[model samples]
Target: MSTSKGSSSRTGSQIPAIGGLDLLKAEINSKHTDCLKLIATNTEGNPSVVRSYISELDNSSFILTWESANPSLNGQIVFDFKKPLSTKAEILNHISGLADSAITDLKSDTKNSVRLEASKQRYCRYRLFNVPGSAVTWFMFAFAYYAKTSTNPISPVSAVLSVASREFFAELFKYAFYFRIFEGIVVFFICLYISSAFPKEISESDVIKWAFSSVLTGIFSSGAIIKLARNLVVSKAKSKKIL
Candidate 1:
């Protein structure tokens, strides 16, 4: 494709704009990552209470406490920070949510089951529908001390990866249970609905087809419902905002 001089000039002009957008995105992501790392690590990148819960400092990964749950503890950040906005309150609110989660964990029974430091009596055994069984249940329980959560300063990705490695494999055998009864029940029901949608009476081929279809439907439907619920909560919170 050949570009006319006018087209080439316009294209050149747009490069700076593109570069600026990229830079802005990098800045925001870097900030979020810092927040997450701080929430996960102490000054030494070694949390004293690493075995107590899951802390998400990034989109894809999380720090599992001895009592952790959801893989993305950073979900609130994902939705709130996705688009452009300039409100100090919003950022503070997000951090407040993180702080709230830490305090709430102490009062609640959830995340304890996954704790590496859990007692034998409280060891929880459950399944996440589509996720690999080892990845979901076993890995979480076995690796409770691999990450930590707190209000410490954040660090670079290289530092985070280093901490994860050092803390990764101390498990010859350790486990426990952290029960979030209400949230756990909701999760169970969602899984049950998806599972029941695919009848076992069907042949292997049919069952596979039904399972895949059901999973897709379940994910989209449940996600939409959750999104609506979150928006409602956010709206109510914003309504109460003085600004």
Candidate 2:
């Protein structure tokens, strides 16, 4: 009787789940505008003049059109997904690759131009990508403040060492940090040395005050300094006919 009961039981077929391709397509479609903005940034083109549209999409491939005010910067890029994208990283990498390729093409076209202004603009655009944004600059200022204030209250050497340590830490963050840190270290030490040169005993407050003032000065003047540095480099390049 038990064997007969087991044989009488029925099994139902399982339904298949929905394909991921549709969801991936939806995600890409939703982010079309953001992707276009990223492309403009990467290409150093004006986002206000950049136009983009997703022309086609299917399970395996998609087509996109990006146009800019400059005709040389307009193009259609196709992305072929060898497999269904299961993660956001896959989608981002594809978009980033497209942007990088477009920028590379633009650079290649302008690399041999003899115009100085055009060459300088291209060079500066490239440098801008490598430079840290304003947020990081402010972070460095905060680091300097903490380093200076937390050191031995009576030791001028401690203040100097604190600044050097701060710059060294900055170097570990990225090469872009190098420029700001170098400028900061120079300002900090020059001010400290000048304060020490006064014919009086340097108090702890004096060291802290000098360091704080120098950091503030550096922060306020950094933009102009960077601009001047860029101009000087460009001028040198022009003189050598390298630009």
Best by TM-score: 2
- The alpha-carbon root-mean-square deviation between model 1 and the true structure, to one decimal in Å, is 30.7
Q: Write the per-residue lDDT of candidate 2 for residues 1-243, one digit (tens) a residue.
A: 000111122233222222343443454546455544444434444454366645444434455566666777566545556554333344445555655565465453322111221222211001112234566655654454454345354466466565665444333333344444565467456545643442112333445554554445455546544444455456556768963
Model 2 segments more than 4 A misplaced: 1-49, 67-77, 82-86, 104-243
Q: How close is candidate 2 to the true structure, as a TM-score?
A: 0.24
CA lDDT of each prediction against the hidden true structure: 0.33, 0.45
Q: For model 1, how does the per-residue alpha-carbon lDDT over 1-243 read when each residue is reduced to its tens digit?
A: 111111011111112222323333343344444333334332123333232222222221122232114333312211223332222233334443553454354343333211211121221223235355324434543233233222342454346546643223222112111222233445545545533442211223334444454444345434433443445456557767956
TM-score per candidate, in order?
Answer: 0.18, 0.24
Clashes of each: 14, 0
Cα lDDT for residue 166, candidate 2:
42
